[model samples]
Target: MHRILVVDDEEAIRKNIERLLSLEGYEVATAPNGQHGLVIARSMLPDIIITDINMPGMDGFAMLDAIRHHPELDRAIVIMLTAADERDSMRRGMRLGADDYLTKPFRREELLDAINSQLKKLARFNREKDNAVAKATALTEEKTREHFREQFAGSSFPASQFSGYTPDGSSGFGVSLPPESSSTQTLQATVMFADIRNFTTMAERLSAAELAALLGRYFELACRPVVAFGGTHLKMLGDGLLALFEEDAQPQEDALSHAQRALAASVGIQDAVGSFKQWVQEQYGQRGLPSFSVGIGLHSGEVTLSRLGGMDSPEVTALGDSVNIASRLQAAGKELGWLVVASIDTAQLAGECLRHGRQELVSLRGREKPVAACEVLGISAVPSLQQTHPPFKYDPASLQAAAVQNSEMTARAAKEALKESLWSLQSGSFQSMQQSFRGYQIIRKLGEGGMSDVYLAFSAAQKSEVVLKVLRTSLSNDAEMLRRFIQEYAVLANLTHHHVSRIYDQGFTDDYAYIAMEYLSGGTLKEEIRGRGTPGNSFTGSPAQVHGRVIDLLRQITSALNAIHKLGLVYRDLKPDNLMFRSEGGELVLVDFGIVKNVGEHTVGLMPERLVSTEHGQVIGTPYYVSPEQATGQEVTHRSDFYSLGVMLYEMLTGSRPYKGDSLNELLARHLHAEIPRLPPEHAIFQMLLDSLMAKQAIDRPADAMGIWRGLDILANKTGSLPKARID
Candidate 1:
């Protein structure tokens, strides 16, 4: 057996890899970090070394560099395991003598294939290896491939499926005829076109060997679903798959129609992406590469299957508008952010399974009009073959819960079934409600809060993206809160400052109170900060740039506060989440006007509505960032927002909030009494800003938004070329 060494900072990932490799009959040894990994690599001289880049001590790169310097470990086939998005780390690893790269979330087959491919290279080039051992490796590799084919395809993947592709880049969409068969025929079929998004760009960056390995893995995963559903996978289209589920595609014993089978196959491919995403997250967590997703377009119509060339250089292909349209739909999916974009006909023709997504009129480039299609969310039904190819998608929590009630499958099957049953329960009511709620057509829910669920909706009259903030029906009985919501909207309706969120409309449905607002793509400052690091502070850039950037943001927040403060009302809940970015340009806007929301005066919660008031009716804001005045239930002013902004600034400059407490009362006490913390040495220039803004007595803070803005202006002028930042 070939020996392998697995190194990673994460215990779970290291053990998972060790288990996978051991089951493959490899002698696998594991290490928790780079220091241990290097020690083991020298002692054991493993045949293959698999190391992750990020670790607590040393790190994979340093360990690999050390191995290169040592003559004994130089011969080891080094496979660097990296987060999918860590291209720079991969390049560095390769320079340090890495033999191969395996992205996180890789399938067991992909891992085995990487090792086998490397072994095959050694067998061919290394003269000392015995011929018998070389032959054994090759044979074993072939057998492994065959087993994989059986595992995913549920049968053999015919070697001659797409012997040659035609020149037009269109074969009319079919499983081509035999090499000697020249007859052309037309028939009705359901066609599924799936292409990897951004594959061309990926191909450009990768070497021939890397590209070949990635494409092989993707095709294997992609083709399995088609072959499993009895659809003929047409592999002529590069980086894309074309499958046909025709009259004779399904087995006679199986009662599924071609459209249903095609739908099932599309769902399977989509599920593979979902599984791959989980794997990537498991391996790399938040530091992973961009998750790969396929845009699959399904349509059922008449297509022509054609054959080209003589028996010597024969090619089986398809030709028809149906094929062209199907391909177009697949490409359109990328722009629409839909995984499966299928025609209405395919959705209607599909059997009893719930069509669990919204309807859309998809526009195509060459066509004069739009094609009606459905955005596939997920299918409630499993494939007719009984289970998906990647049966690892079981929800373990749900399975354990079900296991308490009794059931066991092929060591894993029963758990997957239980998870599927749970999904089936939720998906029963998954279709669009199609209720005539004014002119807003609800696409899908964007988020849910304690009192409301927000949906991405479209206004037919406005012809733009809109968000429907639908409050729960229970809120209707709270007439005082409802009256406040309408009253707040009426006042906010006139505040047309660019930084204030535009409220398009407001109304009440039989089920909820709703407000329509413009959809901002840049998300919120909280997401922007959190994506970079913990709690918000972890920005990376130069010292001046970071300081200047913070100053610029403070200026913008003060500018928005200036607008709201003009109305003589304090923004009780001023924090990172309430500050929204209009776009990538990063202009900030204030959102979720806290005045509109009124949860019970006593309830302390995270929601914007939870602007709390003690039993004595002294009002307060959210904890952590709550101003001293708000925490103590004293009178709040524009200066109160200045205090909150100070907390926000402190959280940004440092990696933590300044105050901490075990409970709400404790937390409030800290906010009221805690001394303002000093900025890091490099950022000490801003200590003056924090000192005054976070004064225990509200009287010591800046008198108005203008006062805060002027302070920021002085800082900006002090630092030339302001508004640029990051930590190095």
Candidate 2:
């Protein structure tokens, strides 16, 4: 019987395979790891070996090299067993002279067929050995007369010389081998690295066994794609895999294809790991793993292929700083939030095969020269066929062209068009307004404010509705206002608060400018109060209903203000007009930022032509919401905004301003010293909050928005849940 060996870490799989193969009348032996498997293969000189690719010590790749050098085992067929579904891995196995590869989750019949096929091939080879030797000798005798044939020499690699070392680190090899006296070989190779962005934290979360499992699966996922593009995995780097390419591969196999494969592997790793975590979550909720992000870097260069270390314990390695830099660049991508960064060399080698963006000079450690890299756009080469590809769009150029066209069209339409423009004399210029949005389907006009008109636009890009605010043209030339607007909008964009409106897009137009914001489907609190009026002649009715709604609105507004304050910004105008009610969940979202400013007071920087008006009037704010100090033209801080919120709450409850006037001068006079009437005892927490908010001195108000929100929360809870009571 021909001898066959099976190596696997799993005892059950090893035993089951042994029994199944023995039933077919072939002698079989099993080992758990690379070290033991090599020993058994050497002693037994098995006719064939089947082993798992992933193991604790000296994986299948390492064992293949050990068998390759054995004089007796060199002819042995090796079949790699893996659970991975990547085709690249199968090609890699074949490149290493593996007789065949079998993926796990296999059928019984498939295993039997693979074994029979290999055994039959071995039998056929044996049958031809005598005839082949005779023919070869006859040919050699004829060639012996030739000078080229006579001078040719052959070298032998023996397994006995490598018997001293073990795959496990139990023993060390004491001898080293002399370098091979062979001419250097040049190969076009693509080197790739797939690394975990936050591997340290990931390791902390998983046990040693779990980590090993994750690494195995990760390597399995990464190796297949590399192999598919005619690349071979060199080794594992903790949370990464190193893959190399060879010269004899197809011409179509270039650095670009390999880089794309690396990126794809990175993305696939996330999906596979995510699925695994999801499974764990379903089985054991709290024990589920955390989400992971991956980054990849690829470069191509000349790699010297050589055997390093002692002959008895040599490792297959490609040494060069290019590989190290590629690895580090992958790590650097984590900071840049890029999935893949390809070096300039890789870009050139890959040429048309590489789909990439503009080049960027990346700073690397220990290197004086900054590396020029590009974001790998995708895997496929740009076909000579396509006239224009969507992803290859010139965003800036298109936008500029569109702006110019829109300007010409706007001017033409204004003169010839019959539709009355939204802007009037009071609305000023259409400073930040968008005219033609190709894909945005305008649902309807949401509301019109003093400075801008907002519409509920369904965005095809976001696949959800958004509020597109078209600003009035009057404020466009106010550079000071524009500067403040830009700075405040930028701060708001970076700030992700649950209670605030998320600013998505902002830009300028020739005659207009626009800001696309999150669209809240509900009506404003102002509209809701008008619909759900208090019982006859009352704006503040049942204490339970009225107090609960007032407290809810207060809590939401305060929460939003607190977030803005944390970011060193103060919303000078805080009232119901700026808050929207989300119909879906009754959640309050703070919107509108036409009058926001920095937290601390500062002198306004005037332009050269506008320096004449240095005297500032009562700063622009809603009459009722303006604090006493604000009305007196005094400096304002975050505390001043709290006072406005208090007035806003009072108006929401009573459907009328706490104080009002027909003229600006009269309004400022009343706001500076007028006493806020106390709410009846039945108003519950409203009176206490109002006392603090309407405090004559800014310091007398609550410390911050949080204090106000917290107090409101207590009142809200005391109102007995207030189910079905919409705060709006």
TM values, all candidates: 0.38, 0.38
Model 2 segments beyond 4 Å from truth? 1-435, 472-476, 484-488, 534-541, 600-618, 713-728
Query: Global lDDT for candidate 2?
Result: 0.57
For 1-728, candidate 1 gives per-residue lDDT tens digits of: 45689999888778767755653446689998889988887666677888888888889899989988875566578888888888898889999899999998887568877887776444222212222222322233223223322333322224233332322343222233644454566878888888766443233223334444455555556656676676763442445567777765334554567787788778888878777667545543322123567788888888876654544433455667777778888866654456788888788777567474656576675676789987886666554465333211222342232222111111122223223433443355222335456689888779754234678998986798787877543212233344334444554565677677888886544335678888877788777666654333426677776677688778778777777666555677788988888786467778876353232232112222323222432444557787876666666667888888988988777757888864456677788676778788988888998998998888898887777777787888887536432211
For candidate 1, give the lDDT: 0.63
State each model's CA lDDT, in order.
0.63, 0.57
Residue runs of model 1 more than 4 Å from their true location after superposition = 1-436, 474-476, 533-538, 596-619, 721-728
**Residues 316-338, model 2: lDDT tens digits:** 34546666667666755543345
